[model samples]
Target: MADEKIKKVSIICSKGSLEGVYPALIMANGARMEGIEANLFFTFFGLDAVTKKKVKKIKVATVGNPAMGIPTLIGAIPGMSAMATWMMNKKMDKLDIPPIDEFIEMINAAGGKLYACKASVDMFGLEKDDFMDEVKKILTVGEFYALAAGGHIIFT
Candidate 1:
């Protein structure tokens, strides 16, 4: 009998805002739940998702998102971003979903890997000190591909 193989998964998150950030986290966490070895690599705007200072402060954009509908209009109104963010957070809370920061921590605790893109770090003028401690390393695209090569690679 052959031993079962565990799947390896790689997720690249390139967008910065709330809508962009959550999908990556949710997918990565879901992969972990399925017993896969999952790696989430943050590049460009997605870097905010792993930054210690910025992770907890991620907010939803109410304006210009077609999916947000009514909230989009509300977001277009003055002072609506704050309200939208609050309501979004409240909805997540009601569903027992932890904040993105806490969800990231849970994923880490489950042995998922987190990485930052070296190129993006330099482009954004961010030092290693700017990210959270959970980030395993800052890697080049080639290095990221080495890990992603055989696995299912997803870009969010």
Candidate 2:
């Protein structure tokens, strides 16, 4: 019989905004569910997703997005960020989707790897202690490629 092939996937997140952040998280989580060996590498603005100080503060954008005009207008009225974030969380909950933090937890628990880009960490003036405890390592581009090579690489 032929040897079984292992599916590997690497997800690179480079944006900090709410919409930009979720896709990477969701995709990594999905990869784990499929029994794939998944790696999530956070870079640049995407570092916010794993920063302890910013992870819990993630908010939905009510403004700037063309599809969000009405919500943005309503959100600008008063206490909109909180409201929008709450609504977004509620919708996600209804869909049985965990929060980003919990999603990361699930992925890690499933044996997926989480990493932060060293260049981004330096650029953001972040130390190793500043990242989430789940981060398996801080990797340079070369090191990341070593892990990602021969696997599917996705950039979000």
Candidate 3:
């Protein structure tokens, strides 16, 4: 088993925050770059990364984020989340990290597959039209598992 090579990667994104969503995207992108098959599955709040109206507006979660090192009171201030998001974007821009919308396009262009969770779409009352053009399909959990078969599964 230790000698087995990874042939594919199936990454699940289940959070909506900028910080929450990027890890799965980055991993999928990296897997493709390594010549491994890659699939990205967006579910629950993570669907925001693929939703047409919400993609560009995803923000970093300031409240209840322990990694941020800020007190809950401070993080809950009206403008704090926006400020943190802006700062993060600025830093990422300096480092040449693509925004979520552009990142999805890049992954698609590189032959990576993109999917939205069927249950999540229904729960959010979203239609197929609500997703970005890069999303290839809406899949039930079983369907996703089928696609994820023989691949490493990662949830972010």
Candidate 4:
């Protein structure tokens, strides 16, 4: 592993929530700044991070999140998810973290590639236009793996 130079990184995002998506975006953006080729592939519920409408509003996970200290049942109560999401976003904003759309734009402008999982897109009834304009294409898992060969592959 020490002998290999990391010329590229492919990140797989499988969760849709803000907690899940931001890490992938941060890493991808960081990779490009380091002169490494970066590709972000959004799959399953992670599609929300790439979808034009939902990306900016991706919420924090409240239900089933033990870190929040709320019982799962209580966390699942109406408005709790929104409150958590709002709190997280407020913190992120104060920290100067750009919203998801701006983050994607920055990465794309810096040459990072964005892709959506074809299966997820189909399952969600999303067309190409449903994704952020920066997304290069939608690819199957097999196709994604083939493209991801020869460098580090990270799952977030």
Candidate 5:
């Protein structure tokens, strides 16, 4: 298996937080960079990463995130989420990590396919126009499975 090349990857993004969303984007971008076909499927809160109105505002979840190294009580304090988000954004910016919107554009430009979950879209009462132009289709789970056939499935 180690010798076999990956032909495709189907990445599922189910959370909207910056921490949740970036992993999927980074994986998809890296896959495309390696010449592997890539598909990003947004569902549940993950739809925020694709939604034009919410994409730019994705924030870190300071509360309940032990990785932040802060107490949950402190994380729950007012403005803590925003402060953590700002600090993280600054660090990422310094590392040259593109913003979420720009990262998605780069992935799309690199030939990675973007998809919205049909069930989630309906649940959220969102339409095609609500998503970025990069989203190629709103797909049912079965349809996404079809597209993912023969590829590795990654749920981030």
Candidate 6:
């Protein structure tokens, strides 16, 4: 146990909302900060975080989000999601946290590998050009499993 070492980490980002996405980003960034190899795998709705157009303008999920303390019906009111997203962004800014796009760029520049789920990309009609250039490749589950072997796997 004393000689155990973490050589790599794979963080699976499965949800698209701001809250769903940040945990994976933060963890992958933290892993790299500690000199560990980190891989970020974006799938399904999570693909929003890697898409060039949506990456910088992601919204918080107000509707059906139990953490918000509002009724699901009320949460669906117009502008609720926008307001929540704004509030979260403001809080993060005050805390000196980078915006989503900038954070992704920072992680990429730090050598973190970013990947999109191939099936999702195809199902969603997303071309390679639709994603941020920082995404290294689109991978199927089997490929990801193989690549992530021998290290920790985190699902956020």
- The 0-to-1 C-alpha lDDT of every candidate, in the order given, reads 0.87, 0.86, 0.96, 0.91, 0.96, 0.93
lDDT tens string, model 6, 1-156? 868878899999999999999999999999999999999999999999999988977999888888899899999999999999999999998987788889899999999999999999999999999999999999999999999999999998
Off by over 4 Å in 4: 1-4
Per residue, candidate 4 scores C-alpha lDDT tens digits across 1-156 of 688668999999899988889999999999999899999999999899888888867888899889989999999899998999898888988998888889989999999999999998999999999988999999999999998998889999
Ranking by lDDT: 5, 3, 6, 4, 1, 2
lDDT of 2 by residue, 1-156 (tens): 257665899999998877788999888888888888899999998998889888888877767666766655675776776787888889988998888788778778988899999999999899988888889899999999999998989999
List candidate 6 segments past 4 Å from native.
none
Predicted structure 6: lDDT: 0.93
**What shift in Å separates residue 41 of candidate 4 from its native position after superposition?**
0.5
| Pairs clashing within candidate 1 | none
lDDT, residue 148, candidate 6: 99
Query: What number of backbone clashes does candidate 5 have, counting pairs of residues 3 or more apart or in separate chains?
Result: 0
Model 1, TM vs. native: 0.89
Candidate 1 per-residue lDDT over residues 14-98, each given as its tens digit: 9888878888888888889889989999999899988988997787777778777765556688767777788888988898777
The TM-scores of all predictions, comma-separated, are 0.89, 0.88, 0.97, 0.92, 0.97, 0.95
Better of 1 and 5 by TM-score: 5
- Model 2 scores worst on lDDT over the 10 consecutive residues at 64-73
**TM-score for model 4?**
0.92
lDDT of 3 by residue, 1-156 (tens): 898879999999999999999999999999999899999999999999999999999999999999999999999999999999999999998988899999999999999999999999999999999999999999999999999999899999
